[model samples]
Target: MVQERLARRRYGSEVGQWSGWASWSACSRSCGGGVRTQTRLCLEKVAKDNGTDSGDQPPSRAETGRRRLRPIQCVGSDKRFHMCNEEDCPPEAGDFRAEQCASFNEKPYKDRLYRWRPHYSTKRPCSLTCGPENASFYVTLRRRVIDGTRCSPDGGTDRADHVCAAGHCKHIGCDGVVGSPRVRDACGVCGGDNSTCHLVSGIFTEPHLREGYQLVLQIPAGACSIRIEEVVPTRNYLALRAGNKEFIVNGAWNIDNSGQYQGAGATFMYRRQTDTQGETLAATGPITEPVDIFLLYRQMNRGIKYEYVIKRNASLSSVLPRLPNDLQSLPPAPPPALPALPQLPARPSVVPRPTGHRNAVPAPGVARPPHTAPRLPATPAGAGQRRGGVLA
Candidate 1:
């Protein structure tokens, strides 16, 4: 069989070349199991189809049908994904998409200029331009026809209903504080644009008054959720829910010392970490869904002021409770004191076995008793001598 195979190879049955793999594409993200892709070509098939040895491109549709479908299994899939860059967030500062959303804009729409805030929530739609500051002058819709609806009066658009009848709706996130940045595409780009993220901050009160509200925050990434870093030093009581889990934070300095009127009631603030000497802790979440952070507006009226950070594709298991690398510095605690050993009863000294000398040696620090030999009775000797004389 080996010889036949060698003969076939000599006859050029086995081509000298096979397709090689392509270079890997860039990683999809900085962390959280982002992916990269690469591919290989079926060089033999490409050569047979194009009458060329080099495999540069795929076979055309016509060419594929012209040849028998099962001519050969020469082609491989064009792409594959591999997870990479799954590292924890650095302890130091980095990009803050949340902060970028806290911007303001005054965009012109027709005769009126709309005061535009950063869009945070995903529930809103984007607007079109209308510039006609001059008489008989006006702006027009970028999409004169959207979803089969006309952008103009004759086009019969559903702009009044906030629907994209005239064209496909545009979901944008830029300088918007109310839009959900979490509604991004696979590339993490917001609103089909390179728009950055906005920070979701608000004061949640008990009975949402005209000015009060229940704070709702979107996670930084769908796979990785939000990280709420406490900004203020004071205690604040809060009840928040993400997915099926619920969380509560009572701002009282101490649980035993807290009262209804004492400290952080329903409302608090998310200040910077440098504002207090105590460690400004954070509430981490791998929330797969949106998080509702609010209070029962009726229990308390004041709102809690807070800020947050974004976490994407995070390693929930590998991350320590504290900041990175801080766990290693913790000192090893001393072992508990051991109970004293019990005393033993006194016993006779154990004498060492006799050495080559006449006497045995005593244990160190032990004294020995005096040694003596047994004596015979003098009467026995006198009796024996008298008996002998009598016999004579």
Candidate 2:
């Protein structure tokens, strides 16, 4: 009975004996669901003369009548944690765990030096597991990774949604709160409805795609929540190029694994499903540079579906409106005007002759002489019969 009473006295009530929480510790990371901690001490007040303190004894004796605080193991937890630095890490910054693994570059483990890379362990998410390039064997460098390191190697790229804290994985919602139910809306605004942005969607079915790479779409800067998919299975593959004509994905006719790729100051998630025979591209972005999507056609193309969100009041370029799709729809210019023809001589007027008469008619203004009688020769009467009585 006495021992039980003494034990209860040494470890006081959780709230009553504990001190107020100290200021939170520095965040474990600069971005991506970092964690901050606060700690409280379990204390018990005792007369200075008792000498029953839990820590080191004082150099000098204290007054008999005075009291001092002594720390004890409390019945409750001594530390508490909350999420911090929930914003996304920049694309160029790379992955936090990957950086940790790379720190062991040229490290010796099995009688040889090697370049190290992060090897994810689903069973122990918080462990720092590393492997060499192009090698399947891996080793656990540390039992626990630094707080704020991503729990999974491929959780995401744009943000650190899940992270390790105090050797445990913790989920941070889109609202940046731990264990919250909030999520991003269609516009990718946390806890918001779909009213913030407008949807832009279209299908490309050009009926004929050339034998090589062809432009499928040009996603402008300042667009958000972009998605592109090949709706029907085909031998064609998708490609991406920056505004400077630099290829971002599937360049040089090489196939890339489904993963996150950085370009145009944004990160794109590429997914290829062989089982479904479809390929998809997605991003949560307000990209800072324009990117053009291309289709590499080895065979016939069925169709591609694409959609994105853009704010209102954006200017649609009247100039080169058909710039997308390789500008195949522009009208042909008209032929140059023909040179004027040279002048020709005028045709002469024609006059008709009276039927059965060989003589040409006189001009209309000439007047004929008064009527004249017929005359016959007298000596020539035996040659022909005279028609009139004048001469026979």
Candidate 3:
């Protein structure tokens, strides 16, 4: 149901483009230069559509068209004002210049010198008030026109309404405030001239569905480039539907990147099992549905490219560890601590006493004790050293 609604909205956008062509063509001629032939063709089409004759008047079609599109004017005996087709206004009387005021002729018919006298300058004031003097003039003019009274040469029309007949009107009121018109056109809203409005053929949208994956595409303003990549697992089948084509990921694939693959510097990923699905068994056993992957890229003038990939479900764990050499570096683990050893007690050392020998010789020229054992003489210890030294 969601997909159906998206498709319908896309079609509606296309229809709007066709309906706006007339306005777009007219606007292009008004703004673009050096496209004389194209502009002429566009203008002719607009004229035919609007019920105006193309070949009737001036040297330039644009000028002729402008003249034919006369501004609606309101004229009264006391004042003369211009009204666009959309709004009502009183006529203006204009002001007499200084020269005209100075040259007022008292003698009506016999003044031969009238030829040298300056004529009054009848200058129509701005429709909207700019200041106090202007406000006074506009108010007095509007009142006189409403009352059906004649104004002096120096006085203007009682009221002059400057209505912007353009689709999106910006009416500047007498109080110096600019207000939006009730009617609006697409041109004003989009700020587009003819070419821009016409170039936008249409817009399309599709509901992206991935049972357990959430995807978001980020687009920068004025960036005409975009790219998408999809990764699929090996054991479980994955399928993606984009536009009219369906893609199938045959084995464990790094469609674009993500998951454990992201740890390996991959940007996108897809998991083998649906986390939300958990261990709950479906009526049809383990769902072997193919995982769908979509890739989309767009570039200015180059246009847009969309790609899809599908793969069987094999958990990301199986695929991530098997990534190529470039992604093989895993984070280092901490060293293990040394095991503790059992403590042992210290042992005591024993010393042996020296024995008497050498035929009971006296010790160093001294007589031995009566019952004590005689000590061996030191008789050149070097000689005895030749024999076995210690207990020998």
Top candidate, metric lDDT:
2
Q: How good is model 1 by TM-score?
A: 0.21
Q: What local distance difference test score does each model get? A: 0.31, 0.64, 0.22
Top-TM-score structure, candidate number: 2
Better of 2 and 3 by TM-score: 2
Ranking by lDDT: 2, 1, 3
Candidate 2 residue pairs that clash:
none
Per-candidate TM-score against the hidden true structure: 0.21, 0.53, 0.12
Tens-place lDDT digits, model 3, residues 1-392: 45434533653211110112111112111110101111111112233312235465434788657645643221112111222222112234222222222232332323322212222112422211111211222111111111111122222223222222221123433332223233222222222232311111111111222222211221111111112221111112222322122332211222322122211111122333232211110011011221223222111111111222112112222111111121222123332332222232222222232453212222243342222111222334333221211222
Q: Mark the 10 consecutive residues where model 1 has the least summed lDDT.
A: 256-265
Per-model RMSD to reference: 32.1, 32.7, 40.2
TM-score of 2: 0.53
lDDT of 2 by residue, 325-365 (tens): 23432122332322222332232232464553222222244
lDDT of 1 by residue, 134-207 (tens): 33432323422212111222112233112122133322222221112334432234444323322333322122
- In model 3, the runs with Cα more than 4 Å from the true position are 1-42, 46-392
Show how many residue pairs clash in every candidate, following the order shown: 39, 0, 36
